[model samples]
Target: MKRYTLSSLITRLASFEEALAQKMDAKGYVEAAERARRYASEIREIRDFIIVEMTLEPIETLDPMEFLDDAANPEEVDNLRRRVYTKIAEDVEPVSGELADLLRRLSS
Candidate 1:
């Protein structure tokens, strides 16, 4: 069995955030749509990365952002984000609240 280190997961999250900053070069209010797409892509990558690194089997996290349509509210977003990370945490090692906390930031 493989031993999952929390540091590695955390490092991966940090690296993802750094790369997100670099890739999202879309500036200003006019380019909001472009920025949203870039942001969504980065989030998807991080979600997939975390799921692959920490899961026991393949998990389908489908874009949580998709749930935040025109009718969705802030409470709905919070609930969806909470559920996604909670489900991930319930799966395997590095199963700490810290891991949950780190994963939660991916959508923020």
Candidate 2:
């Protein structure tokens, strides 16, 4: 089994976030949006699990400006945040085998 570090997970999550944004912007791309939502949920679950395991406080405030400083429209930032939060609230399947194995190793 392959091992994954926290930094790697964070990097992967960023990629997922970018993919989700692109999907959200694409016209008539329902399937892509669904896939992006799944990826968002997975990323959220992994992040929450790690925070709990590490006894870290959950981030309470997310400043969209931090990421969207160069964005042309402020509404786009709000839309992105809403989509991410909605995905996080939605029910998701249990973590995949690879992530499960990684968690097991981390907890060992």
Candidate 3:
């Protein structure tokens, strides 16, 4: 069984959110969507990375700029964001148990 560390998950979540913000600032909805999609994809990868890093490989830190690069195009990022959000919302539903709370904050 693989151990899941909360600290690493928190780090990856923060990084993903930060990157999404940068993607929004750098581009329009489309680019933002693309970036969001990639971010979602990478989140899963990061999860896997966390599991592996705990047992096998050492984790490599990301460059500050790495988060904002591919997702900088607004239109692309927006599309990605929508898809990613949909997927993530579904995946996180059971554990979070606070969709309304999240939505309220997100809307604010």
Which candidate wins on TM-score?
A: 3
Least accurate 10 contiguous residues by lDDT in model 3: 99-108
Residues 1-108, candidate 1, lDDT per residue (tens digit)? 123344444443344333333333332233433433444455444444444454444323323333334213334434554654455444423444444654556434
lDDT of 2 by residue, 1-108 (tens): 122344344444456555545645564455545655555565556655543344322222223224443323324434554543333222111323333443233223
Q: Which regions of candidate 3 fall more than 4 Å away from where they truly are?
A: 1-11, 23-70, 99-108
Span of ten consecutive residues with least summed lDDT in model 1: 62-71
Put the candidates in lDDT order, highest first. 3, 2, 1
For all candidates in order, the CA lDDT equals 0.41, 0.42, 0.43
Q: 2 or 3: which has the higher TM-score?
A: 3
Report the C-alpha displacement of residue 106, candidate 3, in angstroms: 5.6
Q: How much RMSD separates candidate 2 from the native structure?
A: 13.0
What TM-score should be assigned to candidate 2? Answer: 0.32
Better of 2 and 3 by lDDT: 3
Q: What is the lDDT of residue 91 in candidate 1?
A: 42
